[model samples]
Target: DMTMVLRVIIRNRLSENLRHRFLLNEPVDVILMFGQIMQRNSFTLMCSSLRAHHCPDDVNNPVKEVCPQDTDSRDGFIFARDIPDRSTQSYRVQFRSLILEKKLGDALAIHDKIVSKDKRLIDRSAYNILIWGCGKYGYSRKAYELYTKMKESQLAPSNVTYTSLFNSFANSPYKSESLKLCEKVLRDVKKFDINLNYINYHAMIKAYGRCGDILMAFDLVDEMMSKKIPVNSETISFLLQGCLSQTESGFILAIMIWGKMKQYRIPRIIQHYNLLLRITKSCGVKEAASLHVFLMKNPTFFLPISLLDTESNASENTSKLLPITKKSRDDSAFSNYDSPEKRYNGLGGLDGLLAMMKKDKIKPDIKFFTNILELVPDCDTSENEILNAMSINKVQPDDVFLCMLMKKRCSYNNYEGAKEVLKLFNEYNVKLNVLVYGILATTCRTANDAKMYLESLDSNEIRLNVQILGCMLNNACRSLDYQYIIYLMKQYKIHKITPSKQCLKSLANAHKRGRQIELDIDNNVDVPKKLRQRIKRISYKHFVMSYRPWIKLVRNSEADPWEQFTVKYEDD
Candidate 1:
């Protein structure tokens, strides 16, 4: 009965379409209809008749031959898939995947293909994706160009569009240009009656804050407040950071503004507290200590929600809900009777805070320890606290923690202590990276010791990046080792690394110190041809020439010239 009803509806609709075209004196060429049962004879007959009106030969054409195959299983990478003219969602999915994978070239090509294939499916949302992708990957210029194309296409940019573009510009070198664009977007918001939100203001405020225009930043904050947009903690932190390098007046201004934010009940985060400590660092050690002490004493502000409630309630819930068993069989089971004092008897300050977390069954991560260590001066006490946390498995010992500990020790000229820390890393089975080696190299007492470490790195076949190579070059130059410098240049050639200007300059200094005036122009790939030729002309005398003077002063008059040059050069 339903099939009969559907057939009747199709027949009537087809009749009405034909009548409408005839009445309008318009020619109808092709008509395509979609339904569940295309195999039905009635549907096939109707389609064939409709085709016969325009092409008599198509009356006998098979429906299967005319229709394309179902392409439902062809999902692939962005540029790998054939363009589907009917499915815009497929295109969007592929494009988003390419963006996520940072395949910018493929994403752009697919975007262009999508535009050319189906203009109707290309909306403001599609343009927003392209723009956001470009912005996120540091192509703020290309993002602006995409915005221009969007405008030319008569598509009004959304608030999300403005936010993405503003964020990219804020992070770029063109912060000044971003400010002007921010103003223009504000004007557009007013003209087009688009909703303005915190994201729109965040970039503008941050740009102004970064440029040290604290007044403008505050003015924007006022503007946001006047419009009833909430000024969040991140905005306040940026304002505080902007005031860092200024004089006492700027510090006073920052304090006044912070007080105002507190009065307004703007919620603060850990970063805000950390920024306060950083600001006070410039004032004096005493001020910074006082700030930390004040923050620690007021534990309620920084405490997590789980710690805010009475410990008895949490313990009671855990004790009742957990399955009770023999203590021997369930050694890892929670003990409801544990006291806060028993848990944190020796820990204080940040350690005490971490102990509180442990008692609350909260896990403290490496970042938590890193933040505390950065603020605290006593590495010995902090290291003990971290080890305690590790003993309870509240925090896992990792390379990051080891690196931080070693760095603190090295900073205080405790190289032996730092090396001991590395041994702890090995005990923990933590793999060391080049950064750890670089930091250890910094603690070397003499240039030869540094060179020895570098040689160890090379012997291990560690991949030498520019940073490690620069460190090696610095030590070699300091030792006035011209032979070592030539070896480093050879290393650069082997690695196919174009030596940076700084590295070359260090090499020049090494040459000057070693009295090797003339540059070796042949078979060296590190120095540019022009630079080498110029240096050769300037430092006209070579180290071989120096050997001639030394030989004239001390060599036997009858000695062979070549052997004398070789011996004197080696001795020198």
Candidate 2:
């Protein structure tokens, strides 16, 4: 029975990862995760999310004790203030819930308040939770302060505590100091005999990567592989991200690191492709066109199994180099090119862009056309061309134009431009849609803001769809907003929308990391580890993922959709 359960869990995770490589699930957080610029931005987002969820409203009001009557039903947002029972058991549950909601501030505030009022410190578990929260949000200074308190209480720091401590310093700005701190942590890990299971090394690699110590980062990655530490896509992602366009020679190094994924048998993912794209973006046209054309033509590269990758690399190596690459974009000779089409950019600009299109022999798909429209001289002419090409959808040409414009603006993080385009959509009588909202959500810096935008859209009576919900769900997952994930799942089921694969994968990733924490309370009310895990899995399968098989959901003279889903799936 245990083996079968384990098999089911592994299969679910595999399916989830496979779906993630599709890259159709467009969320800004996923995009930023691959980009080097997001390291500090992510830390900032984590901090801001906590602040947004936290209001300074007085907490003196009496609250009712609404602890879950059933152990299995004890899920969702439960704040510390809501629990009148001030026992350690209730506090631990609330602390984890707050971490899930990304509310580290309130969690710490409540912890301090309780300790000060009661004239005693909490247990190691509470301190560990706070330290983990601090590390997660780049609160290295605060994490060390709590570590001191943990020692003062004579608590033996577990691997979790050490791992969070290492991770908390992942964003240290000093190069040599960061390296020295990382070395010291490693020595401590050994001295304390903390079996961190290689997570500490990952934190170290991230620390090195942030400080531009690419060599050290790769050395640690190679160390993990040499020792067979079960490296995942995230580990390689850090290595590749470290090679992100820092020096002029970064492109070459990025390729070598890119090759390492295949060497180690690590699956290529969307983030891997994005990292390469971001690095190749700075190279000359000849270097970029080969990869871009191939990727644009064959998007399956976004998935694990990329086709003709070797050929693409060969094409890139052999492509004709433009001498204009050495010249500035505005150089007189380079700018005054006699080509029929105006230069879109320096290396090849429109020339390279079109060349890529022609070389690949790809037809004008809607999305591909949207990319092209940005290069066109006249929006009206592009709008007409887009309309004729996409007329089958029956959407107004102006609507398409407005949506494309908004997407272009949102791509550049131009929230103001997107808002203007939205006004134009209203003025032109174009019905706002999921596409518009999805694009706008890209500009939202934090999940809380995204949630509000989604809620306002709901108030406007715009029925949500798979794209909007999936977009929000993916973003919430990226921000680690457990409450928003629940909200998104509820909205999907309430609206009767079938769970799209993208959304399912996002949901699966969210629930995959189950915490089987042991509680210290003597009360029988505390949830058991095994039972808690079982509930999390069951809830994900039956409630969140909508695990209804075909034979039961569709049954009207053997024809109705209701009988299509039944108990057979469970039996199987």
Candidate 3:
């Protein structure tokens, strides 16, 4: 019946008239006719139908092939099979074709039927199909579910399964669930004895990094090292990229990774240079320079081609029966080259370095200049040295470099010198930001001149921020100006500035002091209750009036005998 139905379907596809007459005439009626044909003598009709319409070509025709001459007689049948079992192979191909066509349900049905008919036919390919199918249909749950079933069915998961599962989870929507799956794999690593190679580790690291879990990525690296798995250039490169997203820790981790690379004899690649360049820029130019010096000292460790080229060439020539003289010439040429400088010069230094780089045929890009600009000046000599280095290297200083120089000058309290730097920024047309004002405000605070500090605040060219307010409040408090305190509170309320605790305390103290002065000036004749209570609450020693002066004056004035005076000491 299966053969007959398959033949009818094929015939319908081959001829439009046949399809219209039998299959498409009336969907329900055609189905009824086919059912009647199948219900009556179905197996015999299937064989006859297949023989007539679906007979194989000569290559696959079993009738044309000769049977084995030697036949072993069983109880009721003769058996002499020369061909190895191809049942699983036929089912596998069919399953793959179904999967390719995106007919997952049909593929699953066929797979189950094949496995039921011949349990021995359930192989790795079969499991892979099911897993891949489940993944394709957005059925990660089903895919994992099938993996458990495969394990229970005593089928071993191939590397392909592991790779697919990892990739599936790499961008999975359910990140928490995906991480759980990753943990499961790690826990069962020993049981499966799955060797997580470089690719596996890289994928896992990338996945964890994408999820913003830098610690997990680092842990994976440690796991690889503990297992004695040799880290390759790509692996280290990937780890470094992940580290770049971290804050300060990225630089420290990058240095550690680079050290590991050197320890493992893994030669530095272009990516390694780029990563180190970025790390140095973020960490500081000094750190970058230190790394560069280390690289220069161990040139052979990093420049593998230069180190092994002579030997490689010699072996090649020897294999061809050539003389060894050519190898020496090659070695001498490579050995005479100067080691590439690793020290990071600031932007100006980079310009000089760029000239040298050009001489060496290395075309530097904008990123190279940016890296130099970001280096924090570590000492007094750093700026000039960086400038000299750039000039010597013939690197052209850009606008960004000028801005960075100005920032450095401002940071070091060299505002007088910063004028020239600021001039450069203007010359380069660099837009000024609020940070420039912050720098100026901070400088004013250091100068400790309230006039200059206030003048800086009045500038319309630069925007004032909370830090400026804080500086003003601090200056006012130190000067103990009651009028300034009142002015600041009014300004704060009008401008919607949030007063800090220090500002609030300073305002309250100023108010208390003002009230005490008012009370002192008023005659000792019964003061207003509100004014008396305010003066009483003035605990600050400087604000509290000495009762001895008031008592002596009161007694001298011949106050009533029933009137009492009380004195209490308050800590400052």
Measured by TM-score, the strongest candidate is 1
lDDT-wise, the better of 1 and 2 is 1
> Which candidate, 2 or 3, has the higher lDDT?
2
* Tens digit of per-residue lDDT, candidate 1, span 459-490: 98776676666666676666554444445555
- The residue ranges of model 3 lying beyond 4 angstroms of the native Cα positions read 1-123, 126-146, 212-216, 244-248, 273-572
Full-model lDDT for every candidate: 0.53, 0.52, 0.51
Report the lDDT tens digits of candidate 3 across residue range 1-572: 55456546646543454346444423222322233233333423333333334344524534222133432222222222222222243345555776687766666655554455324456777788776765554444545766777788888887777655655554555656766776676566558788777677777776565444656776776777777776677877777776665543455345445445544566656556566567655542123233334434654332222212233422221222212222332223222111212224321244454454454355554445445545635445667766666666566666556655665676666877677766655654676665555545534432245446556557655544555666566555544543343344445545555655565566556556555556674757565665455445433233334323432432455532112211121211
Q: What does candidate 1 score in Cα RMSD to the true structure?
A: 18.9
Candidate 2, residue 512: the lDDT equals 52
- Regions more than 4 Å wrong, model 1: 1-87, 112-121, 173-187, 190-193, 207-214, 237-257, 275-398, 411-413, 426-429, 443-461, 474-493, 497-572
Error of 2 at 274 (Å): 1.8
Error of 2 at 473 (Å): 34
My TM-score estimates for the predictions, one after another, are 0.55, 0.40, 0.33
Candidate 2 — number of clashing residue pairs? Answer: 19
The CA-based lDDT of model 2 is what? 0.52
lDDT of 1: 0.53
Error of 1 at 460 (Å): 5.2
